[model samples]
Target: MGKKLLNKPLSTRVISLNNSQIKGIKHKKKKSKKGGPIPVKELVPKSSALFFQYNTQLGPPYHILMDTNFINISLKNKLDIFKGLMDCLYAKVNCYITECVMGEIEKLGNKFRIALRIAKDPRFERITCLHKGIYADDCLVNRVQQHKCYIIATCDKDLKRRIRKIAGVPIIGVANHRFTVEGMPDAFGAPKM
Candidate 1:
């Protein structure tokens, strides 16, 4: 056992220590060649269509991205999707459903059969998702970030909260037998409150 222990080399690296290291004090950090500390400029690119947080691209024929829960809530409220959207926004609305959201609804089994039927309606355009997994919220958030032209419709509180953080994107939800929009200016038919 003694000879076996002596045969093994030391695993720890031998680092020569100076007076600063022995005193438990770090040496002065090397400054940049520019002279002072590097200034961090975190520049977030703003969309050209955004005029001081208001999206100018929004107009008649609004494009809305629909989530599974939003469809479920709308059906539960007994509101017609087309008629309700027209009444609320006073515009021709185009509803979009993503493949992930469709997969999520389909996975919910027969309990949400009616929602599945509504999602299959010819009026709603289906958006294909190439990414893996069927997590609708991440897929929706990513799509919204890439294209700022969509107004997300979701009854889920978590989804609503996530959408609110992205500037120039609006959220539509069912309330009081109608659709209420958030993050949109008053001129765009957002709720008064």
Candidate 2:
């Protein structure tokens, strides 16, 4: 008998529910509106300079913040930074490199000497980084967040994604051996992702 009982499946057992067990269990009911229309009060402060998601601060003599990899990618593609920017934007462009980016280039060492030489060029204005750490990506993102006037130049996908979240900032990168910009309405040459 014990052997036969052990051989039987557990699912074959019959179970019954008591009246209290059925009544004690509560069923979830759909929420019903009890009152009239409710007004939602939300306040979001927007900058006065921003007009319809377009930054009025951006114009001719564009200021561009250069990333560490952007320099290497430009060199690899045989693209001249100054000429490429001018050709793409059709305006005077000033390239700014942060101290963290400079440090990152230096840390890359010997093989990137050519890239290092290009980054140190006098034409590329150097911006002092007050924050700690030598992480270039965070430095670039933070700087762009504080100032919407700059156009970020980067080949890194992660950095581009972060910049895309911020409003009114444009991004420029090398594509088809030429520079392409995005996030600006007037930029016709900017390639769509």
Candidate 3:
């Protein structure tokens, strides 16, 4: 038999969690209800988490290009887009409206009166106003190009087509309680790409 290694010793490093840290960690674990650090294999499945991680790390800041029709439909539907926009503003996302579009929304009268009221609201005081000339679709296109905004939200089909043609900017349309983003045209007469 080999000689016993009775003289061997294990090294120790001291560490301790403060009361607040321990409490916070416990609280989080309780609230999450899925005990302790989840094993890598048991956390979000690899494929789904990889896509989410890519978006979190590489997605552009949300910048919504707006028009009168977007505001009108959002108001009519009582959708949360307005609130979402407000949250984006709070988070420093660029939200801009041109003077002509503002005027158009205001002129909508009963058709979009509520949206007009909301636009004048103090809660949205931080939204930026861009003063481009009236009847200047080119100017609007220029703004979209300059900012490289991720999406343009509107409700006017003709205007949506026009914008797509002029700026090549992606458009999100809201109509009759539904909203859809433009994609390349497909065989079913759908807007694709």
What is the Å distance of residue 61 in model 1 from its true position? 0.5
Query: How many clashing pairs in candidate 3?
Result: 6
**Global lDDT of model 2:** 0.88
Off by over 4 Å in 2: 1-44
Off by over 4 Å in 3: 1-60, 83-94, 122-132, 136-138, 166-168, 183-193
| Residues 67-149, model 2: lDDT tens digits | 98899999999999999899889899999999999999999999999999999999999999999999999999988878878
Name model 1 segments beyond 4 Å from true.
1-41, 187-189
Task: Give the per-residue lDDT of model 1 (tens digit) for 47-111.
Answer: 88788888888887999999998899999899898888887788889999999999999999999
Lowest lDDT 10-residue stretch of candidate 2? 12-21
Clashes by residue pair, model 2: none
Candidate 2 lDDT score at position 20:
56
* Best model number under TM-score: 1
